[model samples]
Target: MFLRPAARRLRADHPLALELAVLVLALAGAHLWRRGATALLPILSRAVRVDGLVTRGLLAGALLLAGLVLYVGVYALLRDIDVGLSVPSGRDRRSLGLALAVPPLLVGLTKLVGDLTGVPYNGLTMSAYGVGTPVPAVLASLVPGLLVGACSLTVVCQVLVQGTFARVVDGRRAAFLTTVLTAVVLSRSTGGLSAFPARGKLALAAAFVLSLGLALYAVEAVERDGVRYLAYLPVTAVLGLVVVSLIAATESVAELLFGATHVAVLGLAATSYERTHSLLVPAVAYLSLLLAEETVVLLFEAGMRSW
Candidate 1:
């Protein structure tokens, strides 16, 4: 059943084409958004200057609402696909879980290492400007972060789609290609975030390799020993500590919250996918969390300015 020829051909042809199209469209959308935001900055500045706390709050609320709407639309689209796809097999489930877990863990490790080594990990940042900045200026600061979130979502969706296709094709080469593509997509998506220092870049590279290794090991272990292999929760706990420590080390409460929310959402998405085998669930969950985090941070910054 896993190696059916019809499945192989369907996977080899249609999914690859669909993935390529999605990648092209996503890239185009991101590029256009960045450019359009840049062009609109002056006009936005004039129109939405945050002169008072009320305006700041209003701006925050508006952005949050917009984010929610976008997420809902995406979720609806993904839900349609979910209805058509079958639940994955046990092996596929394990593989998906590992795939989802690795990337965010690696990101957390890079952040921890960067903090410890005095290198700036630029993978994620909460604020682009100081509090009390004009509403447009604040919005401008958020634009890049939102773009980064969008880029990350695109990468995750592509990874999930490609990974599913690889499984359907039942080819080791396809799986390896999926892994490589995932790594590449993640590395590229970081560009939308801050610029890393030299050491930070090296740390990120190392983390990527380590994550890929861990993911491979986890999937193999699960395949060999079944779900019992996942019973080694202590190791997972230690990794969780690494992420928590980094979050605690953050300079401010807002930063801490943002980091925590980021990791939590990623982990939750992975777990949800593992249980449901619905890619849409994780995608929508992650997107919603991203939006919520952005909203909270924006509101927090506005509040700080008000005080």
Candidate 2:
């Protein structure tokens, strides 16, 4: 019962490497496409006429919707995740409750962390790179901003990265790989790594390598005791450092792997809250996170990640 509710359409027949490749290609292509296609963001950041805004908005929406449709098609082809395209059964209601609740909890706790830390981000760094901060613009227009967030986050991070990758890697390794890779991608996309001045970047890299050696030792010791989740404290540190990373760039291998974190987490979350392999749970969770995310664009970015 528990299993079906979350993995109804999640059987994998493709070889591990092939599945991994397909997932990476699909999501990367989608992100690259969205990054290039997002002309509306520029409009949002600055003033534009109503007619122009409407026209640009429509174009962006259509483009985003097309990408979403393409993602759904890929899921259907590769994982049979057609949202099950069916009516919910009696058993689904409990899962539905979880679908509604968990995302908010995740977002809230993350936001709380940011609040405690004053909600700093790559905002200053991003601005330096000529990329206007998106949170404020997103707030300015609820519908358009949300449309971008939902479609982008769902396809790139939640479904493909968090959901699909987890199917291949399991246990703490799943979380470890997920977190590490996500951190890498975020660092690239946000200039987290690049933000450091020349010497600082080298220092950041050295610190990371040293910390990782110690973490690997710790991971081995703790896992010997079985299922200890907190064993990856260093991984959390990596993600946190990414949050404080002061630079931004694009299309790095790290960024791609990072997107995988979103795929597995959201994929699992969405399916768990429903009795079908539908997008409802993941979609709603991500959408809600977009709203709740404000400046804490950690796990979910609503849509805009690179810029």
Candidate 3:
């Protein structure tokens, strides 16, 4: 059932690459046609519309570019850290310090720009609703989730680097990093100028402590045993449910992959948890959970399309 042989033949012939290039050209042409067509349409209203085509295009492009830049930048930054992610040396505390500094910097910049531009503060929407409630609101709310997820993943990624991928062997240290990462990311996202005051700082602190403690313990256990994946059972179940729901509703492959990327990173953590009896526990646990979640969703999609 493997496609490697076929893939090799196609690759060697360079046919698949040419087809991919043609497909991309076709898609780009279609996108420009649709966009320009909509923009060129004659105005039919007697009322003065404040928002014009140029404004709409600019807004769309800016939002898209911002999201892309954030994704690439965040991933690259995490990749540079010496957190022993893929292999473990000692925890590169310097890299850890730098890693911890990132989310706040992002938060500050986003807030400053948002305030200066008079953009609506939508950061609180993640606490109040899931992405399925309303289409526009769901899409709008995803930005914060993406930002928060990026920050959270960085911690988790660092934990993976140090505990599983890197030369470090301390599971608890990895867990500590995990908790710190989560706290820092959430704090940055919640407190900056756009944050809501409803939860209050006291509550945030309490939540952080509870989350940190549990996360640290979970990681420590999962690193040492394969069947010990139970530490992340709650997270796995919740994320699995979310993935299943999205697969049932969304049609776009890009959206599915984007949603699943979070799950995939978590899965990496879970895998490390299952493999190493050392401090890599929580990382493996999370990675396994993520893998299960995303794989289930992807399989379901495949089945649906086959039918």
Candidate 4:
């Protein structure tokens, strides 16, 4: 599955360590090349702004690379689970449609609900001022009411009728990766959570619990399509609510608890045995990053002089 020449060479015998070492050496060489004769100097000792575009790009790249590594790792682990994983029939179109549609429908409905109720929904930030209220907020408040409602109905119908891709991935690691990839995609599309009130933490906590329940319900839905055909209902409803809450409840305690690493830990826990639940490892990593980011942002803000 690897496209990079270096990545392919590193994959010769489960050589994950060798792959990492090679990547590090390549990066170091590139840095040295860029710095020319000054490469050996103590440039690494300089303090750097972690929130800058370059840093963001690096983080994004690392995320992509980590995802690739995890995908391969999961595939390797799947061999031990005794389930043969393969591509699903019609998976491409179905997945593409679901991926493209879910975000807009969820985000749109949030905007519509927020407008009618005066509650924050989707990415609507009240504190970020604009010339006569934010234009996006105004549009969000109105258009989604009708458009999103129709789209949601359409998606629900497709999910109920098509019953897409429930058979191809049976291995535990594959299952975990599926959930993680979904969560990560959702997280990126949901945007930053700096707009939420501190009180929204309650909403966030509730949403997390609800998402966990929905994950279980989704498994059941795949199993039962009994005479009632009501299996997908609960899954759709809980997921819908969770999606809205995730986008609207940014910057709250709930967001911190359900962030990327937390989501990964949850997926891993669900896929593995109870005794193997290592959630705290990802929790600590996330908190450390948050601490580092907070330090940099605080220092930068403190240095700014108010006009």
Candidate 5:
């Protein structure tokens, strides 16, 4: 089933001290390395600003390499030392369609509501931007690499924040931290919230009702698709939004919420992985979200140019 939680209870055979020590050491090194690498290549830090194909391709490839080495290395090292979770051989695939399809619709609905009400919710990732991503040449040249790199980066974050930390900390706290950490990491790279409104009383009411409807519909759609635990994705995002609203100033809410939602989506993917032991669920979802998002952006940009 899609979004099913893991059937097994938490195991604690590994030495917590060793696992944490290694993870901390690796993070320190990774931060240093990222600093140096990004200094040499600004594209690593700001991928969305570039429209050129070569720059985008290089950026994707670099992120893919870094993410793969970091995550695969940590996972392998832990597994070798008997401190890691093994990759499951099982697979569950019923949720891919919803995963691929929902992000764009949600984003589009946010866009539509903003157009009507003049207030938009905060948005999500813009690094998915690729000029004419559907163009055969663009698709062949940079899209695949970017898609894979995104998946790699996302998975690495989850492996560290969710898989690793969950072992040492309580699940709820770990989940929250996962959002906090991921928001910090991605907030800069991702663009702001769904878009504007809520400035005026009328606009606020419209945005709220429309957003609520979309949220409710999204959850219902997930349920109708037979997803169980994963349907709570919107609620998880709310948790992130609430926490950020309390701690952050109003201006920063959208960017912070972007990261929170990003983490929530990945959490669903992680749950799928836990239940089935396959990576396809997350990869497909991310790829779809990007394509769907980019398609929306592309058409909107095109419409604006003509308008």
Candidate 6:
């Protein structure tokens, strides 16, 4: 019943003017929030006790956990009113498996691309783990990567853009719009249109588009064919290689990993919402992952500094 109504609404002629206006407003809001957060970071750092490794780790973890809670609360409040947001429903083990598998594969693909392109891949970008045989530094850096994966305003904006795209369009257009808009929004958050060299930014944007397109395809395949969705692997791998290669050419390995992982997470979140008609599941899962990653990275960075 809910699915039918939601589908019908998506197919109906929604006014493009209204949609565009809303999109502009959302973009503006996202920009302001990102700027505000950036500005607040210095003041927050000064106010918080971060002199020691333990203090820094605790502060970082607390802040990330707070953000996760805020996001979950917002999603819960908006779920009922927005067609794009949904309540969790039946479980799909296959979707869950796919979601779990995607992140590691993305990390591996980034490493492979970096090797091929002769880019120095710094796996421990968040921590100085290699300086000495320090257990705390290793734990601090690794724990976060294994835990949070990475969560930022970029991810929040992505969910908003992709969810909105799914509500308004279907098929390829929806996928394209989701990817393009995410890139535009994330780029703006990072440094506006002129942040990087034109060529570098273009390459990075194209990589995001390609990676997201493959991710969308994977989600659709899994939904339609279940286990037989393994058929999509080759295509996914090839596309990933191209996307990573482009990223390697234009950015650091850390940036490539972040982009690829974010796309994978976005795809997982979108697919989960589509399958279960619930935003809560994905939101919870994402926040949990992000919290873990942030905690580990912060701990590692603090340890490295103290050591």
TM-scores for every predicted model: 0.35, 0.47, 0.22, 0.27, 0.53, 0.50
Instruction: List model 3 lDDT by residue over 101-196, tens digit each.
Output: 433343334334444554322321122232234545433534444443343333334432233222333455544443333232223322121111
The residue-level lDDT of candidate 4 at 184 comes to: 32
* Alpha-carbon deviation at 185 in model 2, angstroms: 5.3
Q: Write the per-residue lDDT of candidate 6 for residues 3-84, one digit (tens) a residue.
A: 4543334334333323433444454444444455556655777886457665655555445545543653464346322433
lDDT of 5 by residue, 191-230 (tens): 4221111223223223333343344445544545555345
Residue 69 miss distance in model 3 (angstroms):
9.2
- Model 3 per-residue lDDT at 85: 29
| Angstrom error at residue 285, model 2 | 1.0
Q: Write down the lDDT that model 4 would get.
A: 0.33
In model 1, the runs with Cα more than 4 Å from the true position are 1-15, 41-49, 52-80, 83-182, 186-274, 277-307
| Candidate 1 weakest lDDT stretch, 10 residues | 188-197
> Considering every candidate listed, which one attains the maximal TM-score?
5
Q: Indicate the residue-level lDDT of 147 in model 6.
A: 38
Q: Please tell me which predicted candidate would have the highest lDDT against the true structure.
A: 5
Worst 10 residues of 2 by lDDT: 189-198
Off by over 4 Å in 4: 1-56, 67-91, 122-307
Which segments of model 3 are wrong by more than 4 Å? 1-133, 140-148, 151-172, 180-307
lDDT of each: 0.43, 0.47, 0.36, 0.33, 0.48, 0.46
- Could you give me the TM-score of model 4 versus the true structure? 0.27
42, model 1: CA deviation in Å? 4.3
The lDDT ranking, best first, is 5, 2, 6, 1, 3, 4
Candidate 3 accuracy as TM-score? 0.22
Q: Comparing candidate 1 with candidate 6, which one achieves the higher lDDT? A: 6
Regions more than 4 Å wrong, model 5? 1-28, 39-56, 59-75, 79-91, 119-134, 169-185, 188-260, 303-307
